[model samples]
Target: METIQVVFLTVLVFFVIVTIHEWGHYYFAKRAGILVREFAIGFGPKLFSIKRGETRFTLRLVPAGGFVRMAGEDPEIVDVSEGQTVALRVKDDKVTRIYLDRLDERSGVVRGEVTAIDLERDLFVSLDLDGEIERFRVHPQALMISKGKETQIAPIDRQFGSKSVGARAMAIFAGPMMNFILAFVLFAVCVQMAGVPKENPDKLFVGSITDKSPASGSDLKRGDTIFAVNGTPIGGNFKLMVDIINKSKDTAVKFDIIREGVKHSVNITPAFDKESQSYRVGISADPQTRPATFMETFTIAGKQMKVWTINIFEGFKKIITAQFKLSDIGGPVRTAQYTSQFAAEGIDKLTFWTAILSLYLGIFNLMPIPALDGSRLIFIGIEAVRGRPVNPNRESMVHFIGFALIMLLMVVVTFNDILLLVRGEQ
Candidate 1:
């Protein structure tokens, strides 16, 4: 039952994050007058779908990722000319399908049976349209159709490629921007509920002691109040005590502590940790916290967001500089595991971690990698500079390759995640 609860919570968190991310693109694309054909959550065979206005919203089987399909985002081009009979599948006055085969221009009407429809590729074919048999490649953009004459083309305003560079950039950038917004909101809520830390300078209270460490070997224990270090009085200055201990580094330091109202002195030597490049006595101090006012909550949350944002960038820099190992990178599985663990802790911790995860997602998506929003912005930047869009075929190919490489990386990361789980790392 506990396992089931964890799994459900993990899935819920993943769904919420992905849905919001994709909705950001859908919202901005619509605002920019770009025709969004489908706003889908997840990938592969869709479990359900419904058409609303010009968009078909869908939920797919796989929960790994989602996407917004926009018109003119691909390389395909539709050409319509005079003297050629084109059969169109119309529904509710909308051109739902287009026939590629040239119709007998003499036939005023053609009839055909619908053979197949490829939703992913947006391709459709019919055996006949009003007695005319033809193959048709469906146009992705929504269109109005009239029977005998040439099919009315999708409006230029509805095409993504026709939008201004600023509009295009906004649409592409909205996904990551929404992520940051989500993180801020979540963090604000957490602060409002749990308050912010209010550190005490005078009192030094040990919260926990690492087992088998120098502090643990001594008379020091959790909840012990330290009044002074060595012969010098701490005078409630926690920083002073910390500075002395850390500066001592492998040197013995005498601590004047009060345990259950009994004054005692204990000598503890600090150990140097290579990873953090810090000296520690293995004792964690309790941080004082107080309820924050509404406005104060937002201020704290904003500061938290800024700090986390810088940390994420620094982490990426470390990875680039080889200071971080790729093997430590977590994928979907690891994310789900962490989400489940945080959820098990309590709502406060869960919300805190969610904010951090959202921030990370936002920053990571902004990386100028192919198949990502940042990569799309790069093309838009080129268009702005050149005053014209890049060749559709070439741009599409680049995105395709980038997408393939991203998938390969995901597979590798996922495999590592599973291996770590098998090895009991998580």
Candidate 2:
């Protein structure tokens, strides 16, 4: 039952974050008059669906990710070859719908082997009816049914490319922008719960120990005040102690501290936080905090959000400059595990972790990688400078290859996550 709850919370967190991200895109696309075919949470087999106006909202089986499918966003979306069969829903003597699949299963529609078709441009389908060439006009808002899913046919006007470059860029960029907004909101909530922190370098103590931290398996405990490291007096500078630990270079360092009014010492070896590209003994400062002023909430939240974003960017830069390790990165499985662990501690920790995840999600999507919003924005920039858009087929193929490679990376990373979990490395 506990395991089930963890899985449920994990899914819920992902659902909320990803839905908001996709909603940003959907909202902007709709405003730009683009036909949004689907606003789907998750991927793979559909679990449930409902249509709202021109858009179909859906829930899918996988909890890993979601997408907003904007029509005409991909120029290669509708392709019907000559000599193909199609069932049409005609109205007012004109084609109102096109069924590209399961032709025998559709009733009250005309079945014809298409000889010539133009879903775009002419918006008509030509057929050999009784060996006579006949063509019928298609409706602007014609529905196309394929694999039992109905999507409105995108005329040139309703296509994403037809919009101004600004609209297209906004539609793509809004997803990440929403993520940053969420992180800021969540951080504000956290500040309200826990007062604003005031660093007390002079009064350092063990606040908590992570499960895999070197401090955990050592004599370190909460409330232990450290006064020296390897006989180097801290001298009211917490940074001095940190510098000493970092300079230790994974060597065992002796810490002199007073725990429960008794002077004692402990030896701890710092571990390489390869993911962050830093050396650490796995501890954080337990700073003294005071109640925040009402106005301080927003101010602190913005500052904290900015700090988290900058830190994440720097971490990625270090990871890129250093030797890349597969274990240095976590996939869906590992992230879910971390989410569960943090949530189990308390709502404050959960909120804190969620805010960090939101920032990471926001910043990571802006990396200019293919198939991401960043890459899409780059295309828009190129179009603005070149006075024309890139070839749709070429852009689509590049994104497709990037997507394939990403999926492959997900497989490898997920495998490593499971292996680490089994080996007690997680």
Candidate 3:
């Protein structure tokens, strides 16, 4: 069914972007000789898994995102809790176990002293004689217990910090770089399928050219043929419009026009329009076709990829600045509906939108916001500049804060998403 296709396509796009993003971390960590325990796609309970060597690859219940869990994340050096109040020595040298009131939820530094050990249950009951007592659960794997300030096991690999600055930078940038690569590939494919749009002089028809606008003062007429903008031959208005919008308000855009078979030059200072955030000489152009050659199609795709990257960054900036709000953002629910609508138009539209969405994901994750690949890179950059790696405890705390903020934002966005969906249904 159409709905099924829409859902399937949306999931495919989401997973591909997420998996590559996580893999970026996993690949570099391995290259740096860091131990990675798990690389999982999605969240919640594991739906399926396969172990390959030391890494366990899992497909989780939630398809929103994924993670590469690397080892050495716990830097506990000294395990000197052997001499305790009630130390029951191992009867058969068997595995020991212990349970805190609730071990799953607690994170951050948990300092405690083990006052008792029940050998039969293999549990180590501890008391917070010094600081806060954090619970720990005993598992099959050898427990890497941390007992307080004295504990110092390099959480991640020592070599991770020991690596050259350039190496660390490369490892950090790899995630975003991979996303850019994905956008480029997708853009190329989309371009090949459908010829790029262009603005042609012969097809120039004004969409809107406001009065008192700079265009009104020029020799250029409404239906005038636009041969080029600033001497660059424009096949279509999309690129030229994009350029105009990105330029400063005071910049004069020159258009070479042919009106009634007579060539003329028009220079107009574009005014900013908030709705589109594009500078306009108060003129719009008719859509012109630019059929791509086989080679040209591939090249154009790469071009579009670059264009999308810039747009994504600008959009995020606008949102952060309060120029846009949560309502302006769309979640997966809306994406699915939009995908279905586009799919109805035909496969070409669906594919094009898919490429666009993919590019969006790749670029957005690269943003230097907290709880993102970009933020991780920023931390890495700090380490590179400081000549010493950031303290793991501090860095983890920062990330936790970022994670919490991200979760709160997600809740708001999801609430907005549901509201929009219900309104549409009504």
Candidate 4:
């Protein structure tokens, strides 16, 4: 039951983030007068689909990611010779009929019944010719008919390639931008709803002191307010005070405490704990928080976003510098577990993590790796500089390779996550 809930929460969050990201592309593409073929959530076989306003919106089986399929983004070269049959549509007719064995090698004009009519493909009609079905790929503006002789190509104006460089960049960048916007908004809402921490500056009151700990042997007591540490004013930052104490490994640190309206100084030495890998004073304090005003909430949210963004960059740096272990990386399984744990804690925690995940997703997608929006932007940048687009086939191959590598990485990380889970269970 718990696993089911975790899976459900994970899927829900994934769907929401991916849908918004794709919608960003769809919204900008349409605004830029580009034809969006499909706006799909998830990948692989479509589970459900609907056509509206020249775009097919679909839900697919896999929830890993989604995409906005713009026209001519990855155009396919249809091998007409491989097709055994041809579909033909009558001029000014909405319906198509397919005819079998209508191909004549000597003459061009062959009549056939159109078996399938796809309105989303811009009057794309399929027909069964010579006992095999084949689709005629033609631009929406210019319909073509071949008489068993030659093929004609019609250039479409509304394709992605036809769009200006600026427009193309906007469309590609919109996805990540939307993700950032999502994270920001979520953070703001969470702050407003949950309130911001309002630490008391007058004193840092100790909530508890561990038994048989260094703090227990010292003059520190519950309800005692710490005013300073090692002669440095602690201020209202509990983290700073804790850091000072933790860094005092085997060294006595002076603590200025105020208890019962009296001040006293005490020196306590912290012992290093190998298991936790930190010097322990073993005292905990409670942080006070108050509901934030509307403007304050926004300010807090903005600061939170900035801090988390920097943290992500730092984390990446650590990983690159080998300071962070690769096995520490978590995939979907670990993410789901965290989501579940957060959900169990409360809605506020879940919402906060959702914002964090959104920000991470946005930042990660902006990485200039192949198969990502950043990489696509790179190609677009090159095109802008050269005044011409890169060969679509080559660009497509690069994206394919990048996508394969990303999948491989996901597999490795997922395996690591599973191993960690198994170890935890044991």
Model 3: residues with Cα > 4 Å off, grouped in runs: 73-162, 196-291
lDDT of 4: 0.76
Weakest 10 consecutive residues, lDDT, candidate 4?
A: 146-155
Q: For each candidate, how many residue pairs have backbone atoms clashing (under 3 Å)?
A: 15, 0, 18, 9
Against the true structure, what is each candidate's TM-score?
A: 0.69, 0.75, 0.59, 0.69
Error of 1 at 92 (Å): 9.7
| lDDT for each residue of candidate 1 in 1-426, tens digit (9 for 90 to 100) | 287777787788888778888889999999988888789998789899988887889999866788998877874345534334445655554446455464444243333555543423454444444666555554545343445322223455677888888988998889889889999999999887766566554566776577667887888876688888877787556678778988888789999888989999999889887777888788877544578888898898999999999999998988788896666888888988889877765667688888898888778788898988888889889988998888988999999999999888888999999999999876
For residues 1-426, write the lDDT of model 3, one tens digit per residue. 376776676676677777777788788877876656778998789999888865789999856677777554434333334333222112234223222323443343333457543321343444454565533433223323333211112222333555566766666666667666776776676666655556333344443455577676766665667767777776555566557535747788777777788888877777777788767677666555566777887678877877876787788889878898568887656666677666654566667776777678767766777767677778888877787778888877877798788767666766788898888741
Better of 1 and 4 by lDDT: 1
Poorest stretch of ten by lDDT in candidate 3: 148-157
lDDT of 4 by residue, 57-94 (tens): 99998666888988778763332332345544444443
Candidate 2 residue spans exceeding 4 A from truth: 1-5, 75-87, 92-94, 100-118, 121-137, 146-149, 197-291
Worst 10 residues of 1 by lDDT: 144-153
**What are the per-model C-alpha RMSD values against the true structure?**
7.9, 6.5, 13.0, 8.9
Order the candidates by TM-score, highest first.
2, 1, 4, 3
Q: Flag regions of model 1 displaced more than 4 Å.
A: 76-153, 198-288
